[model samples]
Target: MLSPMQLSKKIQGNDSSQRINYLYQISKKVVEKNPVLSAYYGNLAVSVAKKNVLKIHPDIKRQLCKKCRCMLIDKKSAKVKIKNKKKTKYIQVTCNTCKMTKYFPANKGNNHRLWLENPEAIVEIVN
Candidate 1:
């Protein structure tokens, strides 16, 4: 098996999306051992996407701390809590390293979903 660094180098020759994904995976794997290095990889992934004008998936984006560029693993690198304010329920994620907090709406009885998660959003399937 190729090491992460070697795998990353191999992926760098491929498409932007694939590179971003590999970088993020490396970041997640390294977070527990070295958060700074994890942040570096995470930042690199974001930069790659930006340089190519590509969009990162919502699920991946949400798992990253915007301010610190680190992976947010629940109860590990970050704390997750369900909060309610003004009758709106939301999930709150607090990054332990940088203390950055992010909120996501999770109100019950609401049928809203991200565009990508909706079935109508897919127009074609590629094999």
Candidate 2:
């Protein structure tokens, strides 16, 4: 029922998604071995997604440094620290490359209480 042009656009979107996934995988594999190469792949993936107006998967997005766009491997490319303030526990992940910091609130008795620890809640970012 769709026009040829519409079908072609759909195919192109699928191709873009596949390419992005491939790039993410490559970056993940090489991140520990060669950070520069991994970062190159990550940048390529981001550029391709941006060009196609596609969103990178949240799992992949979270593993990258927002400041340097570098692939982050724990204790290797990133340093993670937990801090408590006013009875609130939070985690700070600092990228070793750019020294940029990202903080996530922890165990706040909220709905988001450690998504990894909660098996019942679906791991989807809500808006």
Candidate 3:
């Protein structure tokens, strides 16, 4: 088995795909036990990807808090709210750990694309 330093070096030297995957796994595994550590790992992952000029996957990126870099799990680590103003709708995500809020447009056109609206887009992962 590799030592912690060697393991981290191996992860850092990997290609973008593998590195991001490792980061995601690490964040997910630690978020429940220690959110601060998870956030640190998440920030490290984002910085590494940015430094390498790689694209962080949208699915993974969306799950992380923009301000605290913490994993956002609704009712667990974050609070999610949907708001409507005038003719526009937006979803607000608040990071419970840091009290930071992020917003995302809920409608783009005639159709709404909120994750709950589409059945196919929702998948229950048994892991």
Candidate 4:
């Protein structure tokens, strides 16, 4: 299987510009008259790009999961714990199903804490 970085480059590579444009066009075409459809395509573009993001930037990769043609924020996004130990930051992911745990470096900046880690919040960040 391709590593996350490889997959990310493939998705965000210049070759994919056309596909991304197409998704935007489709999403725009249905936005007003068919909002649901617009959202469907928007979600698709985001989904496809998300995997690419994970590949290119594995630090935050686990937050998004593939769902159909769109990338959906895995419920597990909320399950991640960020910590600063010694001179490095770490991410801890808990498996809700099997109770297994995995760890990674918290490489990305902390912009997402407000969204994923915030309580009393019911929101999703697709794009």
The global C-alpha lDDT for each of the candidates, from Candidate 1 onward, is 0.75, 0.66, 0.71, 0.44
**lDDT score of model 3?**
0.71
The order by descending lDDT is 1, 3, 2, 4
Candidate 2 differs from the real structure by a C-alpha RMSD in angstroms, to one decimal, of: 8.8
lDDT of prediction 1: 0.75
Candidate 2 C-alpha error for residue 3, in Å:
38
**What's the CA error at residue 69 for candidate 1, in Å?**
0.9
Per-residue alpha-carbon lDDT of model 2 for 1-127, expressed as tens digits? Answer: 3454663454356577776765666666677777777788788778889998988776577667787677776777777777888888887778777788987776567533243223232222211
- Please write out the lDDT profile of model 4 over residues 78-122, one tens digit for every residue: 256777788888866554333445566665665544433332221
Query: What is the TM-score of each predicted model, taking all chains together?
Result: 0.78, 0.65, 0.72, 0.31
Q: Distance from true position, residue 65, model 1, in Å?
A: 0.4
- Which stretches of candidate 1 lie above 4 Å from their native place? 107-127
Clashing pairs in 2: none
* Candidate 2 ranges with C-alpha deviation above 4 Å: 1-14, 86-88, 106-127
Candidate 2 has an lDDT of 0.66
Q: Which stretches of candidate 3 lie over 4 Å from their true place?
A: 1-10, 107-127
RMSD of each: 5.6, 8.8, 5.3, 12.3
Candidate number achieving the greatest lDDT relative to the actual structure = 1
Which 10-residue span in candidate 4 carries the lowest summed lDDT? 117-126
Q: Could you arrange the candidates by TM-score from highest to lowest?
A: 1, 3, 2, 4
